[model samples]
Target: MKILVPVKRVVDYNVKIRVKADGSGVETANVKMSMNPFDEIAVEEAVRLKEAGKATEIIAVSVGPAQAQETLRTALAMGADRAILVQTDAETQPLAVAKVLKALVEKEGPTLVVLGKQAIDDDCNQTGQMLAALLGWGQGTFASKIVAGEGSIAVTREIDGGLETVDLKLPAIVTADLRLNEPRYASLPNIMKAKKKPLETVTPDSLGVDVASRLTTLKVVEPAKRKAGVKVADVAALVDKLKSEARVI
Candidate 1:
């Protein structure tokens, strides 16, 4: 089985985020960067499949600027066999990204595509489904469990009610959810080893996919700051405050 994992380069979750001075986007200058957390889960799942002998080759792909190579290298350190960089200068919408991945799937002819359920920055949660539609393949989104089979794959997904299982034919797409697995950090040795991993760079035109974005950002703004509240001295005071000052009742 060959699994293609699509990843993203985003602001490190641990770092404090700052809005750009011009309000066009987030400030990224001198900012620490890392792989998307959800993508990390997807990568971990793909690596586990390889470790379990269920997957043969794991190809990690990232679509973004040249800096995205760093994110792809992180996937290699985590055990991806190869990397593909779909070079782009600005952030591409989910639809455009799906188009790029669809082209890749055709070129690589992989048995499966794994992706994060949603990106941290955009939170669009549309690429995997869009790619599946574009390729006319089945999709299992928010997958928490995966069972590789001879001719198909069983995926346990998280639904609003609980968990649901679906069997997808080979050459399907799967998106990772939070409960999939805890990702392991790359060791220094692995990081050094990843330097030798092959990363093939490609352009959207190379695949003959139109890169027009389906959506456009009309405006960007910071979230309103949460207001601080005062604490009451006693349980009786709390009840009084809730009824009067907080006006709950």
Candidate 2:
């Protein structure tokens, strides 16, 4: 069986984001970039499947600008056999991304597709579900555990109050959650070996997929600042302040 993993390049999680002076968007110029954290887990899961002899081949794919190849390289170092990059400069939304992945899925015909449940930058948590809908396949989202078999896969998912397990037939979509597995770092030798791995680039148009942005960002602004708390001398003073200034009596 073949396992496909999609990764993304995003702003490093540790960097402090600042709103642009014009309020157009976050300032990304010259910012540190890294592979999306959730995607790393997805890649690790696929690698483990390959190691366990459940998957015959592991392919990594990324949809973004040319620089996204770096993210694919990271996945390759982690143990992907090859990579495909759907290169585009246009700002892509979740739906468009899902369509792109669907196109790739049709072309690749992988038995399983694993991806991050949500991209940290957008936090939309929609792509995996959308892909499953487009493909008319089974979906298991926010997966914390995955056990693959010859004809099906069982997934343990994290829910609001507890956990739930679902068994899906082959050719399914699984999205990784935080507790899935800890990703291993790519050693220096593996990084060097990844450079020799096969990486093919293609445009979205080449795949017959239209990636036009359906949503518009009118403006981006900073959230309101939190006010400092006031200290009162006594309970009576606190009550008086709440009744007078706060009017919460």
Candidate 3:
């Protein structure tokens, strides 16, 4: 199996985000960047497939600015055979991203394409489906469990009601969920090895995909802070507060 996984660079989860003064985007000035959490899960899953001998090659593909090479390196350290960075400076929306990935898929001719269900920053949850649509291939999104077969794969999907299983043939797309697998840290040795791996860079223009933002982020503001509450001294006071003051009862 030739598995292609798309990774993303986003602000570190622990870092506090500040909106840009012009309200165009988030402030990246001096902010720490890391691989998106969900993308990490997708990378781990792809590596697992390779370790199990189900995958013959794993390529980590990242679409962003030059800084996105860092995200591809992170995936390579996790065990990808190679990396591809589709260089784009503009903030790409789901439609644009899907188009670029589609071009790569045609070029690589991979059997499987795995990606995160959504990018942490945008939470769009649209790329995987869009890619599948663009390629006219089937998709298994929010996959909690995956088992490879001779020619098809069995995947368990997490939905609103319950888990559902489906068998998808090769040349399919799978979007990973949180419970897919626990991502491993890239050790120092792997980091050194990743630096030596073959990383091919391409531009969106080179691939004939126009990089334009269809969705615009008008404004971003911090969510209102939650109010703090005091604990009642005893059960009687709690009951009184709920019944009289709060008027819940």
Candidate 4:
């Protein structure tokens, strides 16, 4: 089985986000960027599957600017056989990304496509489901555990109430959740080897898919600062504050 893993580049979680002066978007210039944490987990899972002899090849793909190749390289270093970068400067919304992945799925004919449940930059968790819909394939989203069997894969997903398991046929989509697994850091040797691995670049136009942005960002603003806590004389004061000031009761 060949597993296709889609990774994304985003601002490192440790970095503080700054909105652009014009409110166009978050500031990316002179900022640290790295692979999406969730995607890292997806890549690790794919590598584990391959190591277990369940998968033959693991292809890591990214849909973003040219710099996204770094993200794919990280996947390669983690154990992806090869990497593909869908080079595009335009902002790729979830739908556009799904369309691109769908095209690749048809072309590559991978047995499974694994993706992160959401990108921290946008927090939009729609790509995997959209790709499954486009491909008319079974989907197991927010998967915490995955077990591969002959011609089928069972996924244990996290739900509001608890966990739900579903068996999906081959050629399906699975989105990795936070608790799925811990990702490993690439060793120095693997990082060096990743530089020599095949990294293919393609454009959305070549795939004959339109990647125009559908949503408009009206403005971007920082969250309001929290007020410092105040001390109260007694329970009566706390009740009064909750009833009148906070208006909770």
**lDDT string, candidate 4, 80-100, tens digits:** 999999999998899999999
Tell me how candidate 2 scores on lDDT.
0.94
TM per candidate: 0.92, 0.95, 0.92, 0.97
Clashing pairs in 2: none
Question: Which should have the higher lDDT, number 2 or number 3?
Answer: 2
Q: TM-score-based ranking, best first? A: 4, 2, 1, 3
Q: After superposition, how far is residue 202 of candidate 1 from its true place, in Å?
A: 1.0
How far residue 147's Cα lies from its native spot in candidate 1, in Å, is: 1.1
Which residues of candidate 4, in runs, are more than 4 Å off? none
lDDT by residue for model 3 (37-101), tens: 98999999999999999999999999999988888999999999999999988997888999999
Provide backbone clash counts, one per model. 0, 0, 0, 0
Q: Looking at model 2, which ten-residue stretch has the lowest summed lDDT?
A: 24-33
Poorly placed runs, candidate 1 (over 4 Å): 230-247
CA lDDT, every model vs. true structure = 0.92, 0.94, 0.93, 0.96
Evaluation by TM-score, superior candidate among 2 and 4: 4
Q: What lDDT is obtained when candidate 4 is compared to the true structure?
A: 0.96
